[model samples]
Target: MSQIVTLQAFLDHWAGSDPEKAAIASTVRTIAGTGVGIADLVARGPLEEGLARIHGSDPNGGGDTQKELDVIAEEAICAALREAPVAYLASEESEDLIALNPKGQLVVAVDPLDGSSNIDTNVSVGTIYSILPFTEADRDNPNAAVMKPGTNQLAAGFLAYGPATILVSSLGNGTQVFVYDRESSEFIMARDQVEIPVETREYGVNQSNMRHWDEAMSGWIKDCLAGKEGPRGKDFNMRWVGSMVADAFRIFTRGGVYVYSSDKRKGYENGRLRLIYEAFPIAMLTEQAGGGATDGKTRILDITPHHIHQRIPLVFGSKGEVEKIASYY
Candidate 1:
């Protein structure tokens, strides 16, 4: 098999294959640039002190509180993409889509800083992004392009700024992981063509929201909690890190499931995870990793996005576990 040493090397291998591959390479190159800056900011300690010193409390359209680093990360990503072939940009930090380059050929949707709520606690957070083709009609109405379904995404990925900065991505090829080499200032391939186990005995969910869940979801959780006494007659374990990127990384490393479903709570009927950025990109990566991603009743990639900031329920991870949850729905 061909050895894939670095992210640029991997992209170059693909770029040699086709024009579409070349475009993807260029876009991901820009994302990597932003990732470097984000890693640096994350590595520096005492984010809370900087948060208090740099900015006041400000919330995004989704009503999630944004920290100072969130804004800084968003700016860095936007700056990197400005010179890329990105025509329309949709971000979690922005209320609406922003047209960056009229003549560009790609549309990007991003969650500049996911899990920012954990920043103060010194927990892991990351950036998520989805890249779609920029069409002629999109030039006429950019929001239309920005609202394209996850199925339309040509590439999707996330940068996890944890103990070691990692970039997990898929370009309709397969899920791959790259770890940042601080000494080299490059992202080196750590895992290639990664796959999630078909079955798992572990699951991750926010148990605090149990009271607000509907019957189907509640029933599923009950079954999981029952362990050996449950319907499956096997023991199970639960995990929740309150950070999607961190949770996702664990699922990728080991076979498991992660659920963030809709509930009876206000503003949560359609779920809280953003479709274009958060759910879509993760869905793409999960599917590419031989896992599954759904909204309890439907495949996440198959859902037609109606708005740029549309939110949806997300249940993803090991194929069997995800399928089992969908069965309950």
Candidate 2:
């Protein structure tokens, strides 16, 4: 086996080997910096005396209630990226894109504290991010740059803060994972070239929204519910953590299908997850791990963004299962 190395050393080696790709190096540094900050916040836990408690209102109007940690994490991530070569920072908590350095070559979108609702219950939550290149034309118009398709992403990743703070990322290469070593105060490489299984008997979906689902989506779940006696020909386990990061981490470690599809509800025509910050980054990671991500009708990465906070239906996981879901569309 090859020797394990720290995340900094690994990133430095890549940066050194590709000296001309300054954006790549900068992205690496920025992600590492943000990951550290997020991990530190996770370790500290909720600060009841301060602003760590659940906020009374969500300033962004994303529909989800914002927690104090969400604002704190966003501030920390933005602070770290401010010094990096990032031209713009788009976040879930913010109502608009914030410009950092106009001359910078990259734009970053982030979900500062995903699944923040779980914070009160001590359930796992995380941070998700995507890095994209920006052109000279994009300097004055951050929205134009941020609205690019997920296929334009240069890099993407997520930090799952559970029993262990884990960082999984892809730099247009295969997905890799690192675990935070608290004693050494560094992220140590845990697994390199991680790939999801092609098939599995596990699945995740918000069954509570079954009544609102469209025919295609409802039919798929019906079959899964039928289990061995149905056409699927096997028993399948159902799981729902009400946390995308936690669900994604579980799929990464094992093999399972996760779906957050569009239902017939009034505001859910396009789904609930943000296309840029949530769906795009997770789709990139899924593809990197040999899995697949889609909206049942088209590849997730192929969908173009109309706005920063545009929502989309997300169905991703084991390649075979994802394909199966696509067939139903």
Candidate 3:
């Protein structure tokens, strides 16, 4: 835990030791660098007029009601990547693959704002990003570059802009956490490799959707609620923040399981999370930090994306707890 250094220093080390990863190091830097600006915008909140006003549904056909900050965050990352060595930019905010540097060797998938629905409420919202090596198998089809499996990711991370602006990432090496220092306007490494407790007594899920969940899902909650009075012999805490990043940060800081499962609801059979950007990056982070992520039954990183904006169920947290939930199914 004593491994303290500025993000730039870490990046320098990352690139200096391996020239082949220069593109990845630079891309991570670009994402985190622009993330600072996004943090400021989020901090401003109501100060920024119409920041949370509904901008209409996502033009990408994801059916998400877009907010002004959502577009702003997406554009900020897009503009920044134009200067980085990025071949293509795929986002949940956009349907088409954005061609950046044709010569760039990497493709970046992003969720501009993970919890934009909570923007107007002044709750925590963050950005998620996944970096993949560019594939030239289908030069004419730009979407092909983004259809790879999560295992193909060179790097994945998310910026949780809560009370503290922390940038969490993994370079396939391990998960690293960086805290933003306003004094220097830079991110400094705050934690080295982190490990989640194998077991936890706390859990998170949107209880409002309890009726939509199937028996396995509802039964699990019921057992936990039963505490020592029912099948489960211990008390458990239930938490729901209505934001993925916020819930994830809690699990990372402490320990817990968060499930956003595929329910019986119409059009939500595959779950609501976009696989490429949201699930992939979070899965990578969780795994890197000695946790696990799954779609109730399957490993998230093992799924090959069929489309750039594909949605899937998401469940991740303490490995033991995750396994327990999977056993229920």
Candidate 4:
């Protein structure tokens, strides 16, 4: 049988009363409590009356349609953090930053229900979150405080709602994964200090956009397609889940690279994923797991966000694979 280590037990053991560590543990627990509830609604799916994807564009002006569950999940997360040590809550579903407790000392950036496009399809999706210490100096200037560089994140995590709910996170230490054990109604620590393999034969990208790819990207694709005859001298497998967290979960499980880069298509120049909520947190988690994350040119954690919803290109996973792709740029 798998060793049963509960989330609370893990946090209690790791935090052990350090103020910052305790705060981080508390904040993570708060969000996870709601995640458990969100998972229940997700499992109900179509059977739940009036539970449907909200058609049309998102209220945040994003092209994607907001789903019913997305709103519920966002509200639940917001409510959960209202008393936590979180001063500001920035969400993908919200147009502006939410002011929580004035005395709180941290900021939370989240995509409440990411990959909403797959909501109706019953495919994998998740909630991505980043926790950063609120800069007291810039407290009055929410923009400045919220736009801190990804390197400043104190903790980051994501709840992948799929075949089995997995809560993966890091508290500036190492990444760990917790599996939801329904029998005990707890998230059990299944893996600690997860390290991604240094090499991988698989890669994930959207092949439908091949025509819009830049020369460097096109060339890289050509080499991979060439298989044994290619410069890589080995065959490659391609996988695309059309969902960031789903793809990331696969990369964490084995070892693979997932890229959503700036193509020539309009509005895609900067890529699709939001930097603060999606890319930045994922980058932190990937690195904590002994992998790498970059934007073809610059490291993800090194990029400073200029706005709450800034988008960016992302290439992440195994170190060598990430570096090899960056060379093309």
The TM-score values for the models, in the order shown, are 0.95, 0.95, 0.97, 0.96
lDDT (tens digit, per residue) of candidate 3 on 221-282: 98998998888788999988988988998888898999999899886888999999899999
- What's the CA RMSD for each of the models? 1.9, 1.7, 1.3, 1.4
Clashing pairs in 3: none
For residues 285-318, write the lDDT of model 1, one tens digit per residue: 9999999999999999988988777889999999
Q: Write the per-residue lDDT of candidate 2 for residues 1-329, one digit (tens) a residue.
A: 28868878877776676643566667766776677766666666655434357675756775777777888888888888878888889999899988887667888899999988777666888999998888888876778988878999988999888888889888877899988888998888888888999998999998999999989999988998899999898999998899899999999999899999998887798798999999999999999999999999999999998878888899999999999988888
Using lDDT, give the best candidate's number: 3
Please give the TM-score that candidate 2 achieves against the real structure: 0.95
Q: In model 3, how many backbone clashes occur?
A: 0
What value does the lDDT take at residue 269 in candidate 1?
Answer: 91
What lDDT does each candidate get? 0.87, 0.86, 0.89, 0.88
After superposition, candidate 3 runs with Cα above 4 Å error = 1-3
lDDT of 4 by residue, 1-329 (tens): 26677899989888997988888899999988888888788777778755565744657765657778878888999998998998989998888989987888888999998887777778888899999888778687876776878899988999988889989989878999999989998889888878998888899999899899888888888899999988999999999999888999999999899989888877788887899989999999999999999998999999988778788889999888998999999
Better candidate by lDDT, 1 or 2: 1
* Residue 41, candidate 4: C-alpha displacement in angstroms: 0.7
When sorted by lDDT, best at the front, the candidate numbers are: 3, 4, 1, 2
Candidate 1, residue 61: lDDT: 54
